[model samples]
Target: MFSTYLFFFLSTVALISAVMVLLSKKPIHGVLYLTLTFFTLAGHYILLNAQFLAVVHIIVYAGAIMVLFLFTVMLLNLNIEGEFQKSTLMKFVAAIAGGMLFLVLIGTLKSFDVATVGNPELTQIGLVKNLGKTLYSEYLMPFELSSILFLSAMVGAVMLGKTTKK
Candidate 1:
């Protein structure tokens, strides 16, 4: 009973924050809403007993990624007054595309077999030890490549920040 209420509360907050992220005019407000959405998602992960994922989600997304997003927005100095208004035709096209995507998602979800419960024994798959083993074994190459990519991105950012001599 408590779990159901908690799930509903979290889901409502997540959905509301997600919508606010899209509807917010200010970039900062949007970023804040996105962070709220991330927090609610992490709560959902915790409720599902995926504590490792919840921690990672809070750290990587709510902590690091949101900071990056806010920094980028500030660096760009975006303002509502400076932005151009979207054309009516562009808005119509976007609405139609969004509706189509929503329909497709609903169809995909409906096709899933809801009667089957996942194996209870497999719940430990989300534990840190299991995750570390999988990451170091099956996904080692991809992980290393991602680290290298991040390193290159940092180097590029540093190079871009350097002043050019006349």
Candidate 2:
């Protein structure tokens, strides 16, 4: 009962923050709203008993990514006078697109089996131990491949960062 209420509260905050991220005129405000949205998503992960995911979400999105976004926004030097105003036609088109997306989401929700109950035995699925076991066992190949991909990306970044002689 309490969980349900908490979930709804968190969800409401997330939705509001997400909307604020888009609606905010100032870039810094938008970044702050986006950070709030990320925090609320972390709250949702906590409510789902996925502590690992919650921690990672906060660390990656709210912490590192939000900092990067803030830096980018600040470096862009977006002045109020230099801001671009949206035309009436663009606003109307955006509203129509938003409505269509809402309708699609509602249709998807209706197709889901809301009455289905989760398996109580699988409660530990979100824990670090189980996650490690699954990754090392069931998803070993994909995990290793992703690690290799990251290594290659790091190498490429280092190569690009190096200053070559003229």
- Give candidate 2's whole-model lDDT: 0.84
TM-score of each: 0.83, 0.83
Instruction: Write the residue-wise lDDT of candidate 1 on 39-121 in tens digits.
Output: 99999988887778999999999999999899888888874542666888997899899999999999998998678678533
Model 1 pairs whose backbones collide: none
Which residue pairs of candidate 2 clash? none
Write the residue-wise lDDT of candidate 2 on 76-157 in tens digits. Answer: 7763542787897998899899999999999999998687578532588788788889989999999899999989988997
Q: Looking at candidate 2, what is the lDDT of residue 109?
A: 97
In terms of TM-score, the best-performing candidate is 2
Which candidate tops lDDT? 1
- Determine which window of 10 residues in candidate 1 has minimal summed lDDT: 78-87
Deviation in Å, model 1, residue 32 alpha carbon = 0.7
